[model samples]
Target: MTTEANSKSEEGHDPFFDHVPERRGTHSLKWDKYQDPYVLPFWVADMDFRSPPEVIEAVKQAGAFGNFGYGKPSPKLVDTVIQRMQERYDWTIEPSWIVWLPGMVCAFNLALRTHGQPGDEVLSAVPVYPPFLTAPANFEQKLVKVPLILDGERWTLDFDALEEAVTARCKTLLFCHPHNPVGTVFTREELQRLADFCLRHDILVCSDEIHCEMILDEDSKHYPLASINPEIADRTITLMAPSKTFNLPGFGCSFAIISNSELRARYKKARAGIVPDPPAMGLTLAEVVYLHGEPWRKRLMNYLRSNRELAYERLNEMPGLQAFRNAATYLTWIDARKLEVENPCRFFEKHGVGLSDGSDFGTPGYLRLNLGCTRSLLEEGLDRMEAAVNSL
Candidate 1:
């Protein structure tokens, strides 16, 4: 038997995540960006784990058929998305509400372009993903950053501050569910307040929910901003993907769900000419992951829970550091202000680990650590972090 076949069908133990693939020469954005053999990159969000077995098998099957041409989304794909949403979130969605796209970042830019006129303002809470910071400027819209208050334990949205910052020129609130970096899954009450704020201001909400499926807390639930009610639904645009959940990001499939006909028409119009359809392989793998990857997803979450615990434990033990114990997402944020360091990102990189610089995410003196890698690598990165912070 071939070595590849052997890797797939090995007996006794699971073969999927047993080894980390050598990604140095693989054109990996995460690996290539650092360019140093010495740096253990925990900066970028992509997982070092292999794509789910179902995804691999489906892509291979599609490639073997050899009919890559102009394509349409499968009815199965739409129905599977509907079924999964209802089953998991108790949220109902119509097939007509789905608009497939190549990436969630595209959805952000589309939302801004479709909703914001020049000089109009777009608001997002700070310490967020980098794309959220830049998307507003891409279309000449004003960007407003409302800081998230750090409660004794977790990050909380300062709704009073958020409401005060809204002005007549503001057109949309670009919200993140299971927020990145800080990883707070906004509670139903928090989301309800957010919904009311938007509805009262008559502002449309574009919620990026890419990490919705990866909630770490078993008790916490992700409520789609639109799923709260019809009033919010008519003004909400939600973006989600299986890429983050099933480690299929490289396959490039994401979608925006817009329930309002006017909003959907605007989004589809903005997407024309510039946005291309997802690759044939992306569609095939997407369908497979949604329908058949749930068992693998459960395994991933259970394993990631351990990694998260190890990270939080280590960070809490160190002096001058307090890691946010997040309820969702594999990413966590740390406040390093107590360390009095000039640059925490560089300090960690100097110790042979790379992390997302907080300043880039609109919060200084804080860093975002990605916990989606192998347990061994997580140990190494954590060790480096401990040594680096201990030195200061």
Candidate 2:
């Protein structure tokens, strides 16, 4: 399991060749599910790239030590999380405040089961990740969707509409910070406004900040919703994971920061027997990466920034395609409303590119593209997209 870093180049090397291995026949969601050889799969949020060299090395080191059993997270791993939070977001967190989970999706499901009743309404913004809408349903909770306003090329919340949507039936408000499928790293002001509104209505906020570390814009910063105000902190469940940042989703390691003691108790009570612990290897790698992989992460971020630029320029050139430049995450939300095709993903699949359908994300006539790939694969996907759009 030798790992190599891409040599820094002027125009950037192909990320597909540089980072991602050909994932065919590997049971990879991003690759295996799409059997069409021509369809360049970019549906799942996971990158087509490999994890950082240091991360791979760390995982290898852990694997070399042959001990596989039920394990508790090491104190070092807990400390690593605390340090990363302080360094990255300037948010201080105690070890006791951290509640470990197998995955962020699990955290979402647990949140609904913990706080809301079977028929209580769970609210979230539209054009978000599919799980945000489906999580509530899993627990038989009603889901209330508030559509985000697309003002020009940016997606923003209509606070007035959101206020109208929040009612006695709505007990929880799930937020996607640095929103998935629509790449908007919310401003601090916007976050404050949201916090204020939720506080006034006494609605508990569950924020998923899993993509907090992949921010591409230098001017943009990620603000944890709980850090905005004490009231918000008392009522918020901040979900985060190393999966998205370190490309370790397969490892199944995620945690929630529950600031308020009562809220923590309730969340823990819901998981008294059901929620399984994160894998020992995942915790080991998470600890090692946090301690020694900062330099590698810096280099990776630089590479992703370049990829984001390349995708932005290439997609903008297509006739009926439009993409909003994102602040964080390798996933890019594309506006394909102008296209004549009924199903954008299917249309792209015909052209040898597979994209996540926007309708699944609660926004039709749009598509989401994963930019976490080798430059060659990205270019090929873009070229296919151009040909498809041209033929239209």
Candidate 3:
């Protein structure tokens, strides 16, 4: 079915524009935690919208069978993944390379333990996802951060700075593609340069491409780090999942594509006795979404592009706010430096709008805003932000 078929109209049926019931009272991280009556949460990465009809239906069909034993990923699940890779990125992936995991965070920890030694350095570009900073330390490795350069409002990697940060002690590089917080989708040339650098330093690369399917620009294509070159693929572990794409994160299913057999063996060894198989329902829905939800996803991207436009236009009109236009992901990175507030998070909190603190992502004086909400909800948040900024 087309995404338009899924959408609801103002007077009739427009699922995309409608307000759906949020599972808040049942331990929802986005809604239940924010208790203040006036506070509007634009903080978390998850969307406020409901899952697509196709995904929900798939899960329901699986529930009908009532066989929830110790889960094993079905051959259908592997086929779905292979089909998606071939269709979306023009990259073919062998089923043997897929390593099932309960979540991407677990995979990150496993990669760190497998690739690096104690006191060895793990390099990543910041401001990045918080786990990228903490995961290395959790494995008894040092975290080396290289800041992304601000070209006007755009965030791009500083290659020279990154190369300088990589030393003999650095063993692995963790990369977030279609990056979190500041969303910058790396170009092919950029990925090639990164691969060259990693090859020169003999550093293994772990690429988190969970946001690869959520592209805002029709012209922009996500290049898997492993697919860039044979050398890089041999040294890379590429992680992806339907959780982010189909809003199935609660389902607890993510997989890593390991091209090199030796590297895969080491990774599996580190994860032994630790990582368990993904849930049966997760595998079920993952297969269903890959086969039936492509049209819905295309429409979701279109809707998200509209949301991004609305946010950018509205945010720029505010006196002291500057939002970086993102090419992918539903998150917008806004610079609030002009507000003159020493603590921007505290400043926004006082105004009843909770935003992710830029400091948390290693970039001060900026805030990340999740724009994946109904237009009315977004407008309410934007209004609160304007009041807060004006009061300052």
Candidate 4:
């Protein structure tokens, strides 16, 4: 791994994050989604910032090798993951517990396949990631959407709604930690309550924790759901990746941690010839970032904190708009139900700001904005959104 220089706070201010690379015409899904060149796309979760410089340099070194072949996670990478879990989350995980995959979407889909039978049910909170909404159907299972109740500024899980929705056929609970749009970093108490609920229902949990490292609030801490206790650990499958944290989603690498031998075997069986290993380059990048990307990651969190504050303050200022003050992730969830327009997303899109439609996340009359961009770009998007809302 390449060594990083000491990152000074004063020096870290502008040069690194302020520069926005031109991504258009490069087949970037975030940039190329809109045919209109003027629209600023913030629909996807990926950041506008380039990945850590150390990671980029590693990529260059790997490319220089000139041979791309079938690859698996190196022992170093697996050991790094094990150490990270133990050190960061205080969760001790064995090497045998790891199962590598090309992407998180595939991992969760495989979770549904392994744990749920056809005609079974999968439960998840509403306004979740779009994949959680669709993965159940892909496995011929019913998706039970439980609404998350708002407690002042934060969104919390509703056990009452969950209890009402649980049924005999409920085989799996699809969970998102540092949850996608709402960005609620689960507290220990919340995790305990959720774990108890799952234990009582015997529901296998597939916790998507891809955003585990992106906590912006100093008071908030991310705990792996399985790390709550051994009982819950036996019943939970925690999915994570460096892709989201390091802006390497295009590299396509992710993993699942299943402590239960039975579940691990089942997951492997489900992924058997159908799923491919993560790309060789992706594994290389993952190892490099995990080992040497901390300084860069720290600087990133600092930058995102300001962006989150600016976004939350701006969106809430707009009439008929309310932005959730999220504890983690670079996503701001907005309530646009009170807007006079027929469609909130199109309204902003027309004004040159493209946002993820809340309807797609199973909640209509709301919008999710990506605050993972430079201040200038984010300000431009917010300005468009404000003008659009004012016209109403």
Candidate 5:
């Protein structure tokens, strides 16, 4: 290892995340799920990298006190959340409008249950994160799936289909910002159109912006739909988390910024009996990350960009395989229909590689590869995957 790899400043972040922590025996869902040490698991969205040193130190400091009792979020944490939106996205909101949750997935589920009635319809684009498909059904609401059509080199929203699919019964849309699986960050114009569509139909928009900070493009940016306009803000319930950007998913701290008092009230009411506040440690870690994790997050963005480039290059080089570079997120979606494998997940697993089955994301014959790992680990997984494909 190089000196740069071993050295860590108290305030600076290392660019190369080549270190792989020993997670096999640590009860990690991502590492231990296969029950096979040989398998390189890339199925889950979580990364293998460590959280920011600042966060780790904060956690250690909190643990030293050794009193893990019930706690409330600090005013500083609330201010940090408010400051982040304004500094990063030029968006503004009050602390009163914010509702903290255990996780981003929980935020959307709670939103669905709060806003939708039984037999009502919820709209979402296909090939989305699994939660978008299951959350509506979990709350006795019907999900109306709209496909994101392929446009040349990238996947795009089919407004014609979206407009046609809207029905009177569809009162809510669980919108995935920068979309999962497909990984396309919707543009400002595109977001405006979505806002218009939802407003025209009087549908509540639950925009999930969990991956907003993991943009691979330096020029590209994540725009919260609610931040576009006041009316849109009133209709939108945006969910975001430091978990993805700072690698704190295990901490389970995420929050929803609902500018509209009515929607916030409904969400709070629905969550009253079920949803619990994030743990004290999560709150402390969130504050540390938000305040001191910027240097680490920037380095991570650079590292993730390289992984994206390598995956984009190698996957497209494979025979009968096609992949497009995404503007955001560390996930790359591969179109494996041309490969003609009956079950790509099983096929790759046989060769010691585990990828997310596209079927789980509403897109059959496709796979989502997580690029949030070391370059060498990613290369090894892809090499094994390619060797498997060649065997067929």
Candidate 6:
């Protein structure tokens, strides 16, 4: 890296993230999943860094009160969300439009339930987050997968394929913005084209925007798929949260933004009776992060951007591996088809590096590596991967 690039990379890296917490014995899903003590985990979306100090302090304050009870989102948190939309995206929304969910996966199932009948089809581009593939089946609806084509360096939607794939039973499109597995931030032109396509097909769009805040490319910006136009907004249900941005997934808090009252009503009805509200701590942390998490978020993004560059450069150099640059998120998607191995995930685990299997994301012969760890740890994992592939 050039000196200027190096300086830019270190712009806002917080010293706090340097101290990775010891999570092995804490019943962590990522760390404790493997019995081997030397295997480094890079499979899950969970980050190794602690939550923002402000969020931790807020948690402490809540602990002092010592009363854990069922709770609803407060007025302040709702208002903060409203303000965040307007300030960040210039998209204005009313408080009544927010429908809280315990997690984005629940929102996915609810989107299918509210918009489609059993046996209807849910349209989505693969490879995507695993839930998008299974949510349709959970609702007895069929999932129609459209492969995203590799256009140069980035993976993008195939409009022609999408048009050919849509049928009368296709009722909803489960879209992932700043998409998982393969990170690609759709351009405004692309989103506009998608909005037009959905409008033409009379398809409801359930956009998963969980990684909106982690844009790694300086030139890229996130536009809520619903924010494209008033018409699209009416047919769109956008899922967002502070969990991915603030490292608070264990709290289980997320929400859906629905501009159309009728659609919003259907969503709420689908989630009623069974879907539980977010815990009190989740709501409180959300409030604090939205109100005060910007500084920490900026620092964390800087650190992850550096890690992303390192991983991309290093992984692509491996003889049988290919890695693409991510426009957003702390995940790097790698293609390992050429490697002389049957299962890449298990193969790497044997080499002391655990990666998310691409088969789980509807694409075999590929792997998703989490880049959201301390710099030293990321370096160690990359070193292990490099040596493993070199040996092969």
Q: Write the per-residue lDDT of candidate 6 for residues 67-86, one digit (tens) a residue.
A: 98888899999999999999
Each model's TM-score? 0.94, 0.96, 0.95, 0.97, 0.96, 0.96
lDDT of 2 at 15: 36
For model 4 the TM-score comes to 0.97
Write model 2 residue lDDT over 1-392, tens digit each, in one string. Answer: 23335444456563323656778888888888776776778789887667767777776766788678877889988988998888878889899999988899889888888899888999999989998979998888898999998877778788988998988889999899989978888999999999999888888989999999888899999999998888899999999988887788888889999989998999999998999889877777777677876666666677778878988998998888898887788888898988888888888998899989998988889899998787778888888899899998
Worst 10 residues of 6 by lDDT: 1-10
Residue-by-residue lDDT tens digits, candidate 1, 135-230 = 888999999999999777889899988988999998989999989989899999988899999989989999999999999899899999888889
lDDT of 6 at 153: 92
Please state the error at residue 350 of candidate 1 in Å. 0.8
Model 4, total clashes: 0
- Candidate 3 lDDT score at position 138: 93
Give the poorly placed runs of model 4, Cα more than 4 Å off. Answer: 1-13
Cα RMSD (Å) per model? 3.2, 1.9, 2.1, 1.9, 2.8, 3.4
Worst 10 residues of 1 by lDDT: 5-14
Model 1: how far residue 132 lies from native, Å: 0.8
Per-candidate total of colliding backbone pairs: 0, 3, 7, 0, 0, 0
Candidate 3 C-alpha lDDT tens digits along 263-368: 9999999999989889888887787788787877876776677778888998999888899888888899988888778888878878988889888888788899
Model 6 TM-score, 2 decimals: 0.96
CA error at residue 109 for candidate 2, angstroms:
1.1
